[model samples]
Target: MGKSGSAGPLMTLDINRFNGVPLHLQISEALRKAVSNGQLQGGERLPSTRSLAGDWSVSRNTVLQVFETLISEGYLEARVGDGTYVKRQVLGDFTATSATDERPLETKASYPFRGLSQRGKALIAHRLGGLTERPTLFMPDVPDLQAFPIRSWLRLMNEVSGRLKGDILVNVSNAGYEPLRDAIAQHLRTARGMMVESRQVIITTGSQQSLDLLARLLVDRGDPVWLEEPGYVGARAALMANGCSVLPIPTDEEGINIDLGRSKFPTPRMVLVSPSRHYPLGGTLSAERREELLDLSRTTGAWILEDDYDCEFRYRGQPFAALQSVDRDGRVVSIGTFSKTLLPSFRLGFVVVPIDLADDFAKARAVIDRHAPIMEQMVLAEFMHRGLYSAHIRRMRSLYAERQAAMLQLLDETLSYTPPEFECAGGMHFVLPFKEGVDDTAVAHELWKDRIVSRPLSMYFSGRRKCSGLLLGFAAFRAEDILAAGKHLAGLGDLIRRND
Candidate 1:
């Protein structure tokens, strides 16, 4: 049980007798032995309760008690806010018997890490702030909540506040609130055509939290993770941070190509895709490709993460039902977010996992952030029950449909003959693939000067591929604005067509 403080990240424990001796006691003994034996000398910060929860396969409360017991015993120090750090002084001095030898790094605090050390800042830095401060287009993912049904929300919140008994309010389900999950299950079934029970839905703080939870649960270091070539960059960053080797899959007009993904990065354990509508590209996955993916998952025992990102605003005919509806093999984990559907800042989303993995996934979530903000969950549930969510979505659908039409007409009249192959099927954004070799970054840079913000296709690549396209989100923009931006991009589009 000696913890080579800097050795392996986890310490294995006997869990077969879990129901007997409290888990914290076992953990305390294991940690104390590691320190006394000098395997763990000093000054090592223990993994946060969230991190240990995943490793021990136990609750955060269990780990919390373990820390408290060890701290009281002088074996560990609870620094409170900054997390628990191992006190090297616990063992007095291990090198007191040895001749005093000092190294340069030893003398210097904040020494640069030797390449292999875990203390180094990650090699692959995350690129962010794309739309974090109000998307360049000035319309971000969140709706102006002030314009939403705030009065009705406040009334229901007041009602929930009044009804909450002390014990009922204090209690929590490791997965989430049961009534909220049931409400979400019903909402998905009636609105988005997904079939699942409340038991399958695990609520989260937006899709980012869902990605973090999935990485902790499924991915080991360097496990192959396949992502769309021109996809959401933030998702890639999340997977990479968890030590997954991300492989990029090229997209055609009909969404992610299954044959290409399987042939290219064939050994990946998980494939992430936005099948309902291709992200940025904004095309539905052809039926053939959808079946091919499910077939691949069933045959290879791989799990598919279907990000049903923005199916709510179809703006056309009935949007395709989620891919999980037919995934009978328990290989699909469907994630959806209200970030775009209602508001982004609300940061409420859920993952519909197979029933078996639901408990473990919740354990992983509890490890990360104990249940999402309860107040927001309560408000959303009330919104759904009082029929405001449905009405709001219906209103947004009509508004976005008009905006998309106006933008398309503006494009046809001002710039190109047509946009990409997909036509307003569903999504907040659509792609206009530039002629090959047309630097999308340069084009976007030019657009930025005019305050007409457009995302370059190359930015989405996993630092691979010579992709040239522009991703323009229409839902966030008003008709007049998209019209004006189309005019500016047209001035740039002419240069492309002429070069062609």
Candidate 2:
């Protein structure tokens, strides 16, 4: 038993011997709490280590260790000839109270500062949907993960890792790995028919980051930006987050209505479009409309943002060349991602900017994230160099085509009513239109209960005249899985057509 010092009695600690917690940690926590709660006052001397050890029934080394920890943390200070004392400044403005006083401290209920800024709140409010680590059946825009060539990818990764030296490791480019940029540029020239150089390609994390960067650099706040109505929710979110006034331009079989957009919001700062294949609806922009859109952009001095996403998955005739291929002036900015082609987790994408704006985009990229992961970029470059990426794309095209055919057949045989405007040539998903009175959102929620994932087409529309439908994806699932899910969907045909 240790005697009380001149400072008064040491506070009693309820140390549980039966518990799994170590004795030293419990003792240290007790002392820390005592100091924090004003039980131990500043400049007050503590019991000697030996006396404390005896009183606490712990080893002397444990007590010494605890004292050293507290001293390092500025809770206590050690003197040469004197005992350890609480630091004088540790209890600033706190009244010294007896350990026996067990009254709880009072605190204010509310804070003066607001939680989130208006921009932050708006950014979160525009979220389209939640993402899952493991995608379920019929989830739109998800690639088949199980079919990815992991062995070849691993081999390339190992090769890149082995070749890494001090110079290569330290001297990474701010824009991206040079070889990867070159590979991407070359691929775009041949595949998408875009006349791009490595310098014009600014690599980004994915399409989302590319959109965010372009919005920040190209347009000012409250500027008019036209987007396809019943369009991609992500594009809307990105534009709205940057304080752009998003104008919903309706689309038909020929893509965004250029004449309609001109009549309503003629002087838009930027126009975002998926001309190769319209999202959800899957309509390729007609050649006439494409020319008209470009001419309009030139007249209005507006920038055109072409989202060439999933253009590689076209299962029908030859896919149309990228809109950037026909750009006479330096206006169209093209962006694409590998998430739909390769893996979503890789987050590899690129933006093709005009030659004059390339340096500015690179500088902006440097400020944003420096670059994508260096090793992954190097690996991807090598993968493309060996023609593995092309091969993988070819294999996926065949696989997805088969899956899509199976899904269409299953839907035709299963459903009682005819699917409206269900002619999709090549894309990940197609919209199954419901009657005007039918609630697509309620039907989608009901499908979720049966473990069948589908995006409500109404959620994609920001305008008051929303379309009632469901977007069903066929690319990510196998034929058998599609068949299994289709049976469950068949049972809901009556519910889907009830309003009709």
Candidate 3:
């Protein structure tokens, strides 16, 4: 009863221009659906490509490509003289009545195998806080990507790329590029006051990988590991992923409570601390606590992981010498990353292990990823060797200090109350504590809706006593943007009032 060839059925395609799908693919899919649904009957001829293009407001070539694709897929056939037609074989036993009458078989969705392992589930449970790939306003620990020295970096990259030859390409070191290790060791000796040797330094993808590698290599499964309370979530995730039992040790203005940890979780296999400047809180570990921590490690035979992230960005006075610098024994494994000082995407970080563990760590590094990219290492080595890396750090320190000052001034003028911790000497972010009854997570969620990114302080805690607050980052934001976002933040005045 239908016409042998018709364009009427193809006209109601419901093409969407705003859904980000390609026009040709959309047209092809619509045609296939029409044939499958029996809306277009078997052996029904389609309109000419030009006619379809004009009707759909698409190019003639788009329609032609769509026809060719469907023909190849056997959904449609093309004749020399006649126009395109739906393949009758494709509709075998698929009559117009059957297409409408036959329903899809009723079946529940089922997976082929068992679900994730317990370790996988634990890793998911301890996952780090949400962070957008592209940095947003007030996103903590993100550096100013726009301010990176791309010109100098690209020049170094070009220089390195040109030098890549037989041995450079084929004979990669398991430890890392040697010159880069030399540069890092030299920098640590001068800048961080750590007496590290190039042979002891092993390059990793980043600090996250460094933590994971150390966790798996240093500790056995179910070994107790002491972590700073309200500590780095990534560290917690890494340790838990390796089946380590995380023991949260409370911290104060001075740093991790050494006495409290010894009294409670006494026999930890390892102790991880951000001693240079405690993350989020900006508290420097006291000299006494550092000694105590080292003593604790010595007596207990536990390894100490010093996460010296963002140590180079200290705004005022000198940061304390690295914990590794004071380690009498080689029990301290210091991890450093360019993610904070340089670009996070560089994926370059290193660990200064004890002399005995260097070869073992290098072997593990080889097993994991066979070392970081060669060209990047060469470029970074050149950059550091030329003193450009230190120069960049100095520039970023001044810029971040100005931004921090601007943010503090904004908060002071806007908010009803300001916490004492807001006057921190250095660090990328400041924690704004909320009253006991206030839900910091809910407040953070509401701020996100207003295009202001913040991490709820409660999310950082693995222990029972969780503090409710928000970590507001200023390092990556310009003064004007910080002011603009601060206005929105000020609107939540009562919501962020201090508990005291």
Which lDDT values do the candidates have, in the order given? 0.74, 0.85, 0.85
Off by over 4 Å in 3: 1-109, 128-133, 419-423, 497-500
Tell me the tens digit of each residue's lDDT in model 3 across 354-414: 9999999999998998989998999999999999999999999999999988888878888
lDDT of 2 by residue, 1-500 (tens): 54443333455888999999988889888888788777778888888887787787888899999999888877889987677988877633333456655666644545557476766776787664553334787788889999999999998898899879888887777778899999999999999899999999988999999999999999999999999987888888888888999999999888999999999988999999999989878888999999999998899999999997989998877789999999999899999899999987878898999999999998998899889988889999999988999999999999999998888877777874443442457888867777687788787777777787888888889999998888888888999889877767886565453324
- Per-candidate TM vs. native? 0.72, 0.79, 0.79
Angstrom error at residue 239, model 2: 1.0
Give the number of the best model, judged by lDDT: 3
Off by over 4 Å in 1: 1-124, 129-132, 135-147, 484-487, 497-500
Which residue pairs in model 1 clash with each other?
Answer: 42-88, 142-344
Error of 1 at 173 (Å): 1.6
| lDDT for 411 (candidate 3) | 82
Error of 2 at 94 (Å): 26
